[model samples]
Target: MSNGRKNSMQRVSDSPRLLRLGAGASPARDKQWFCNPGSGAWPPPTIPGRIMMMNPDQNSDPLFDFADADDYQRLRDLLAAAGFLDESVLEAIGINDLPDLASDHPLLLDRTAGGSALHTLIRLFLMEMPVEADTFAQAIRPMAADSWLQAGLVRRHGSQVTAALKLLPFRNLILAFDLPALLQTPQRSRYVMGIGGSTITLSQLTIRRHCRQTLDLGCGCGVHAFLAAPHSSRVAAVDLNPRAVRLAAFNARLNNISNVDCLEGDFFGPVAERQFDLIISNPPFVISPESRFIYRDAGLEADSVCRRIARQAPAFLTEGGFCQILCNWAEKDGGDWGQQLAQWFGGSNCDVWVMRSESLSPAAYGSKWIRHTEFSDGETGFSQRFHQWLDYYERLGIASFGAGLITMRRRSNGTNWFCADESPERMIGPCGEDVARGFALRDFLETVQEDAALLACRLRFSPDLRLEQQFTPSAQGWQVSGSTIQLARGLAFQGNSDTFMANLMIHCDGKRTLQELLPDMAAALKADPARLAPLVCQLIRKLVEQGFLLPAGQENES
Candidate 1:
């Protein structure tokens, strides 16, 4: 990283606070007033009386209590009618991004000032700002505002009312969870996290094929379980945090989804011996020094939680089932990260694919996660915590941390393969189909390991494939100097190739075997096919692995 970027990161890491609240909200007051229900610290020593207590039993808790199912349905409909779904809320706020804990709230509030009911909802729930009672009441008309207040969705103080919980409209469903500010406090260890980048990334990476059963292991607020509900006959959402379980159950009811069973237990203990066709988890895999938060820390040693999940997941997966996990793993100095990760899945009876996204040094990793939870602590406190984390890493002999998605498929009979590669920086859209295709392609490659077998099988270029050439000004006018072959969508893998390779890619039309195409390829290169066969086979295998080419008649398999 450049010095400028490093300085920027340092500033973010050392910042005193994350949330910048609007009027009537103070960080000190929030810290003093807010407390987890079952932490034996409820009713803070100095209570401002502005915030109400959240019941330990979520069923009795106002936030989870839905006296009337229609009321929740009406709430969902009201928000949807006002165009408060998915990314539309971002567009309505005149911003292309969702507001986070570090977002400038006052500026966002000013942008949405004096706007429609949608804007009111945005300011109240999304921005976590206090709204005028009259404005809030008007925004939620037809459905009595008292219902919202009674349900503990919002708390009133004099004429102003603030949302007690966050209502996130994501993927056409309204998910309820604790406010983002709660995440910054140690007291709120049981905080149920709302939608985050990891949640969305795991959802996109998950295979969407219809399944007999789906398990959302470590399911927070049931986002993955809900996403898997439509295609799955039954979905089981398990979490160690009771608060998360309650919120997930409440969300399922709020969305009128009856197929998801939300349970609270550690890891796979809740559904022991029960097999699932698909298992997805965005587990608490952060390799932190302390287990302060349930949603982020696993209370285990360095990366042990992730390793445990990988080792145990295959036992719960039915034959040919997939287990996809988003996690962080520790990397030792001068050690191979891939080989270490492969050891986690050794003798697990599964084919593992590790798509590493990024690796960061100990300092960088410590700064990033510390900035996330301890941002509320001032610079001095942040510095202390940073050094403490560094000490922990040093004691553990850790050099860096690797963050990415690990996908494993339960293979009963065939020789299982372990494939590891750097993932593409960006995905065009949902790449679940691409993930399935990748496994199938890997399997195909395994079957045709020999040169003769690979050449005997006909292959075709991916329909989304595109080849581009760049010309340099040479004595010979416009001679092609370089070229690249790329997939236009789905994983969007792209790499440089020469003229011979470009021509070879275009010729894979599923009409001719590699043996047949070799003659034309060799003629273009003015070389004998006998001598060029091995080189051609090597290039074709690479193309197939990168998804630029597919075996004939297997491109469209689910």
Candidate 2:
């Protein structure tokens, strides 16, 4: 580790206000709903409103063994038949979040319209509401609601049964994960995050290449692992949190996914001697100064967990294997950000690419995470956490922090490459193939080192490539002010170009090699072919590297 990294880590560990927990605090203090700390748990320092809580009671576990094929399929059938599994159904009901759904919504207003099972199930499970035991039983009939009680899914209070867990509906799959504080429940520490925008983004960006083994490091509820299972012969989903492991297993069962093996251990710990062809992690990448939630914060100073994962992943990847991560890293006060990240891959023999989506200053970044974790706690508490977060960042000398996706491929040959660039403003569709193609292109470029070699190969512009022209509307007729080229499909990239280059790019229809096209292009431009050849070749390399143009036979491979 560098001195800068050591200083940052020291700053996090030296926080007098939050470095250690109260001595007398016990896991037994909280009820059965608390998460078990087991051996790896690091309880957060006792802030007035932020004390960590955990309950080891086995009865608190959700009853749905969503892992059982027959039961899970039956449950899926019931959810589908009841119309509770659709994404649009929640939107139609105006149920964006738990607090948004009004008490007077039709689902709540008339719980049993034709004795609707969907309505009953949604109210009881998704909404975390109480229902009469008989009504609940009637609603989930043929599946038996008593089975839920025995599974610790619901608890009976007098004649009413209250839900203990939430089975959220995600794209053709049901995920049973933890929920946050509601009107009745206290602020939760054991909250297991479910399907959200971050998870979806990571999933969409994940490459889908077939592999013998895949690993989902820090697999929270196993979403990434679940996505990898079908394409991989075996997948190891590892997490430090036992609760997360259990919940992930439950989710796998819920979806009838059979190939994932959920293991409870920290990053790379459980799979010490094992290697994989693909590895994915939506780890606790938040660079928090203080630990609050286990799902989001690694409790390390700066982004140490992300740094360690990136640096160490190569050791656990097979030759030509790829490791992808969604992470955040600090932009230190006196360090070059790119080089700081480049150092993580030092001596790893891996090709690295980063697509940064956003960057935030210390103040803005602290405020965003503070608000996310403390929003339900009320404004006064939120204000305090936000200030403390900013103070911590200042002490650590983090000027700004960047969030991005990183992909690394372990290459057997000694030569390696590192690319750090901005991603598209908005991702359009599944660009996993685009990522794979980019890596393949990088490998090909490594082989075709000479300019003459590249010129001899045939190339063509991508079908999704589009040319756009911009002009200033003045007294002079539409004078060409500027022009740009864009990609409409995967990894959308837009770059400004001159008319010659734009036309030059459009004209390459894969019919001729670059050496053949240069003479005709130069003749059409009324420029010397000798002078244009080098410039056109240089531009072609840039365009091809950015995915604006593809080599002739490489188009179908994408």
lDDT of each: 0.76, 0.70
- Cα lDDT for residue 134, candidate 2: 89
Residue 188 lDDT in model 2? 42
TM-score of each: 0.87, 0.82
Error of 1 at 264 (Å): 1.0
- Model 1 TM-score relative to the real fold: 0.87
Which regions of candidate 2 fall more than 4 Å away from where they truly are? 1-70, 87-115, 182-187, 376-380, 469-482, 523-526
Q: What is candidate 2's CA lDDT for residue 367?
A: 75
* Model 1 lDDT per residue over 273-332, tens place: 589999988777777778776666667789887788898889999999999887789998
- Deviation of model 2 at 64, angstroms: 5.4
- Per-candidate clashes, comma-separated: 0, 5
Worst 10-residue lDDT window for candidate 2 reads 1-10
lDDT of 2 by residue, 79-149 (tens): 77878765645654655554345556666545434456777777777667788888887877678765666
**RMSD to the native, candidate 2?**
9.2
